[model samples]
Target: MHTSHAHTLEAARYAALAREDHAAGELRPLPNYALSAISACCRAQMAADVPDTTADLIAVLDSYKSPEELLREAEQKARSEQEYEEQQRAATDMDAPNRAKRYRDVGTATQVIPQLGWSRQMVQAVEYADDGRLWLDSNGTARLINRAGVPGRVVASSRIRLLRQAGYLRSENDSEAHLLVTPEARRALYLADLHPEGIHRDDRAAHAARLKVALTRRRGKQNARNEAARLPRMDVWAMRHADDLPATLTQQREVIEEQRRTEEEKATEKVCTDSIEEFAGRIADHLDDGWALNFEQNPYYLDVRYLYLVHTDGRKLRVKGENCGRDEQGAALPAEKLKVWAILPDTDRPIRSDE
Candidate 1:
């Protein structure tokens, strides 16, 4: 063997041993494995001809963390987050009195407008505001009445204040009441028949960049929600067709298949429970009405007796495997093949399906 190759191989061996020792070191209370890992690491570092394996090993040793350590860090992070949220909630709660006081000095309304009518004044005011819901107040300031009794604040006075604040409207009207759509708003909002005027309208290329980005973010969230609503149906469909599953499914089939089986078992258990209840109920009702139990030995199967009840009124409760008599040609009818899935109370009584 070549000398460099021998050195590389020895270094690789020491590196492997170091990793093993490091793992063991974390587990034990004493520092015995830590010393062993350090010794192995030193040997690996000294004998290494090139940097590759040795560098990788050093990186692994420096960065690798145990499952417990990772879990503890996660728990600590979660606790800190919870504490921060609680503090925020507490601060909000404490400030509630002051918050209420802020709104207390607000004035009461003298009269309620039965409904806002689409008169010429209201129409012109809405046009001026560039907002449909807005109407001129007693002072001629454009306002939106959300609450019936409470007075609404000005959305536009000499300018469309609220829309400008929302970035959907801007004023190139400059010292005038009329407002203009922002370039971002022009791209995002579908304003038609309103003022064609806008800030940066001359720059035809700057089409609503900011509003487009905001809309994209909103669409991203909505898309996430859409996938959230859709993806569960895949698991449901997979379980529904579990018996006919193909090998192409990437989800762990062992766990999914086991869950499917468990669900089937539960369904089977419920059926069994229902059958037992039906059986006991029928037997109780029959015995109460003077029906007698006839345990007759089977013809084909040795030592097996069919259990059934007979009534003097020509009504008979037949066991599933009971002989309903031989076929027309007198060949023994296959009694064993009769109605295996049928439960107890195979009655002459009328039911909804019968009706």
Candidate 2:
């Protein structure tokens, strides 16, 4: 007898279901006649003719194997599939991070802007700013000119204004003349290999040089204004002590010298006071031997004062001092009789009198 392909396929499917039932322990202790029918069904699958009905197909499957045999086969097949999956997962875990990093490093504005539906020219214009901001004129023209003295791509103004409306860029000031790139825009530009001001994304030296030049210019302007303000004060001082201006300028010299000395003395005193108190408290809580303040001395003039600390093993450290004296009102008192000194732990040498 011959069977059609569909009938053969159907018989195989019924056999598979019976096998699952056995594996699940729902079918057991198969009868001999059923086992024989199942075997006959398996053989029929190789031939053209096989069972035409589902019942006949299932009856044939029952003849081939007992429930216990079917269950064992199912379990073995499942174990093999699980092992294959675990191997695939382990391989993926090892390669995932490096793959992700490579993906991130390859991003460029040309590639990213297209994804956001923005034109390449817009990104180019934004990248022209050395400071991540673009300034425009009343006519919506960019205020900055390139090295060749040509106007920038002000035609992209419409696109920039649209982007600002969409929240990708923001007005830097009230004039609506300047736009700053928002973080989102900067990130997109970074991914696209488009850096502002023609600067290389990773060129730290070039970036620092530009920053230094800007700061120096600002400082120079500030200094000029300060010198202008001080000119009248200088004239008045010179008039008050014409003789002293040529000889020693003793009063002016003393005022400047005292101001400098007082600042140094206060700083030294603060460091010594904080270290011996606050730092020592935290250290004591953590160490078994701990630390203790040994002694502190106040100086009247020109000699070093001391803050001493003792460790568990009897080692002593002289930590800090102050030289300038202050009256009750915190005014700078005469320093003619006061002395200050300290022995630093790192060098174990007394601080110089002049220092």
Candidate 3:
């Protein structure tokens, strides 16, 4: 048989064997046999052409790899490509302008004297000089007077060049070739002053008076209205003594607080004393000398106290009372009414009243 026909028959036999092996569960070795059969067929085809050789076919067969290995290599190649793309994206992001940093750089540039190692005083001098002109020397170089008002050094050529480039200075060729200070340069030479326009009339006296009234209102002072009537006099005194405003306000607040506290304490004392006296008078009218009145202040109620009226037989009645004239339920009680809540030493439950 011809070599080409023999190769085809051998390939067909191997392919059939590979299929049989796969059916018999020899799956791992099947691909190797199948690839060998394919390689043989390819070589047979190549041999049919005279100039063509089996070298290409042999190389393809020699370079065969398992499916798992080939899949791993493909995944690695994809990961490499993805990583390279990410690196390029990150570099592009880094090259974008940072607005915050650019703003800071602009502020720094605006504050400092640009291009020349001159101090702020020198810049100010140039701004306030008689002519404010930068004259050019015969060599086409700009020159400026020294700090002592003597024509000494040539203006830094680089500084003049940079100023021109930055639009802070322009060359005016009228009458003489001299450098003209642009509006931007004039603005840069501006000296910021607290009293830029002129000194005005002082309003500290009025300010202090307003501050005092504001503080009094904030503290909820009872005499704030009465004190406002004296604001004019207070303003005059505050201006004369200037530094005493805070101290005076503080003293007034302390005095008001002290008076309020003293009034509250006295009111509370009168309420408690009068309630006991009135209850004692009522007891004197109804009961004999053997009856006694015992009482203690209630801890929970701010303006309330507890009273125990002991009878001759030792039966005690408990009374609750408020100095601010209200009951435990916050209902308004008569100023003369002593609230009787419970009676003790009962045969059954103690008699109780909500009033």
User: lDDT of all the models against the reference?
Assistant: 0.40, 0.48, 0.50
Shift in Å, residue 64, candidate 3: 57
Tens digit of per-residue lDDT, candidate 2, span 1-355: 4454554455566656667767788665434334444555566654644443446656566457778978997899899988876674465432334434434434433333333434456556556553534666566555445566544544455555555655566665545366566655555555445323333333233334334444556667556444322211112221232221121234446879999798657645532333234433443343334456544445542232444656777778654444233334545444332244445443445643233
**Model 2 global lDDT (CA atoms, 0 to 1):** 0.48
TM-score of model 3 (CA atoms): 0.20
Give the lowest summed-lDDT range of ten residues in model 3. Answer: 191-200
Looking at model 2, report the run of 10 residues with the lowest lDDT sum. Answer: 230-239
User: Could you tell me how far off, in angstroms, the CA of residue 182 lies in candidate 3 after the best superposition?
Assistant: 61
Q: Candidate 1: list runs displaced more than 4 Å.
A: 1-78, 89-133, 136-348
**Candidate 1: Cα lDDT at 174:** 41
RMSD of each: 22.3, 26.5, 31.1
**Distance (Å) between predicted and true CA of 70, model 3?**
56
- In every candidate, how many clashes are there? 2, 30, 0
TM-score of each: 0.17, 0.28, 0.20
Q: What tens digits encode model 1's per-residue C-alpha lDDT throughout 264-289?
A: 55533322223333443445443536
Can you tell me which runs of candidate 2 are displaced by over 4 Å? 1-113, 129-133, 145-155, 173-176, 194-270, 274-355
Instruction: Pick the TM-score winner.
Output: 2
In terms of TM-score, which candidate is stronger, 2 or 3? 2
